[model samples]
Target: MAIFNTRDRTIECRIVYYGPGRGGKTTNLEYIHRAFRKQTIGEMVSINTTGDRTLFFDFLPMGLGKIRGCEVKVQLYTVPGQIRYGSTRKLVLKGVDGVVFVADSLEVRRKENMLSLKDLQQNLAEQNKNIFKIPLVYQYNKRDLAEEGVPIMPVEVMERDLNSKLKIPSLPASAVNGKGVGATLKECLKLTLHHLQEELKWAVQDGL
Candidate 1:
């Protein structure tokens, strides 16, 4: 659920980047912070936990215009993908409005990707949010590894393994190189804002 500030005329929402450990979630945030400097409102904060790091930053998207006369403020976050950080992952997802699952493209990580996704589904369910209904996007990261003679799954196979049932928007990306990063975030933002619009309408109608 997004926080609606009637007095400030602003609506703030959270979007989390989730996937297996070392799946390039942090890289995506770094690229966005570097490339979209004008839209970023604060320093990118990173919380280190043994083997993984959780990161977040606030972003004010431009050109999408206001929603119900309120400016949309987005808070982007990445959950630590290590399995030991289950509690932390759930905490990060507490009030998520959208999600970007950054699956690793390496063939060896196929199982890790599936497991992480299942963990996501369970975590969302715990919060009374359905994974299928939430605004979600799939990003198969590290496509560039293929060019380096590394074994990587084809996008079709990744979709079959991860998104065949959901059929949400999925993109092949090389986050470290900035490929598809902007597009992935853009698509997620579009879906999230659209979802929020309907929610806001209901709130108004219900006199909340």
Candidate 2:
């Protein structure tokens, strides 16, 4: 859900980057925090466990200027990707307005990718949000790892495994080097705002 602050004429929306452990969710947020300094309103807060994996979530609050009379603010978050952190992941997803699913391209993580996506759907269901209806995008990260002799799944195979049914927008990215990071965030933001616009129209129609 989006928080509309009437006093400030602003709407704050939550977008989460979700995926399997070590899939570059945190890297994406870190890159954004570094790359978009002017747009960022607050310092990014990241809590990492011993292995440097996100323990809770990485938060970056940013202002995206005004849209349709309301100042649009966005809170970007990355849920803890480790399987043992399932409860924390679910809690991070509460009131999420949009999501970017970061799928690891390593061949060894194929099953982990599928399982993480299923976990995402289950968590969203718990929050009463249909996974299909909500604004979602997929990021196939670590594509550059093939150069180092790392076995990686082909883009087509990843699509078949993760996006066969939903068929939403997907991007190939190496978040560590910042490739496709901005594009992924922009697409998610676009979809989220569009969804909110539709909801606003419906609310007005119902009131009328």
Candidate 3:
């Protein structure tokens, strides 16, 4: 979950961008970093290795407005999407309050998306977070390639494949050109707000 420093009167939330390797996970965060540089509180940090790269960036999200008189700060992150980096994916998801699953559109990556989604579920389960219940968003990234007979799984196909049971917000996105990026974020922000309320309620009851 995002770190909200109530002692310091700051609300911080962690949102993880997750998908298979080369799914544009990094590209999505980079787009946000560039698009909101003025409002971003820090730089986008990428820890690159020969195997994979993990990236993170933060933004003072005014769009989420105020919750209990505290403004919301969003920390965007992406795990090393490579399959062999499974440990790293779970590590990065550690305290995630929200998630953006960036699925690749290429026809060849269909199984990869399915695998990544399952990986996400397993990783989150290790932390007691449930995809069926979390504040989640799905970005069918690389939508621009839809016409190329690429994986371009129809929205319904993805829904059936990934979101059949859980009805989180999903959008067609092109992270390279920034289409649907902000919209995807806004929807997640709303879900996050609702999630926080649920969390607060549980906290009131000592996590029930």
Q: Top TM-score: which candidate number?
A: 2
TM-score: model 1 vs. ground truth? 0.89
What ranking of all candidate models by lDDT puts the best one first? 2, 1, 3
TM-score computed on alpha carbons, candidate 2: 0.94
**Between which residue pairs do clashes occur in model 3?**
1-95, 1-96, 2-13, 2-14, 106-151, 107-150, 107-151
Question: Residues 27-73, candidate 3, lDDT per residue (tens digit)?
Answer: 88778888876657777777766545543322223224454566667
Off by over 4 Å in 2: 201-208
Q: Where does candidate 1 have its weakest 10-residue lDDT segment?
A: 55-64
Candidates 1 and 3 compared: the better one by lDDT is 1
- Model 3 root mean square deviation, Cα atoms: 4.3
Candidate lDDT scores, in order, read 0.85, 0.92, 0.76
Compared with the true structure, what per-residue lDDT tens digits does model 2 show for residues 65-150? Answer: 76666788999999999999999999899999999999999999999999999999999999999999999999999999999998
The true-versus-predicted C-alpha distance at residue 77 of model 1, in Å, is 0.6
Clashes of 3: 7
Worst 10 residues of 2 by lDDT: 199-208
Residue 127 lDDT in candidate 1: 99
Q: Which parts of model 1 have CA positions greater than 4 angstroms off?
A: 49-68, 202-208
Clashing pairs in 2: none
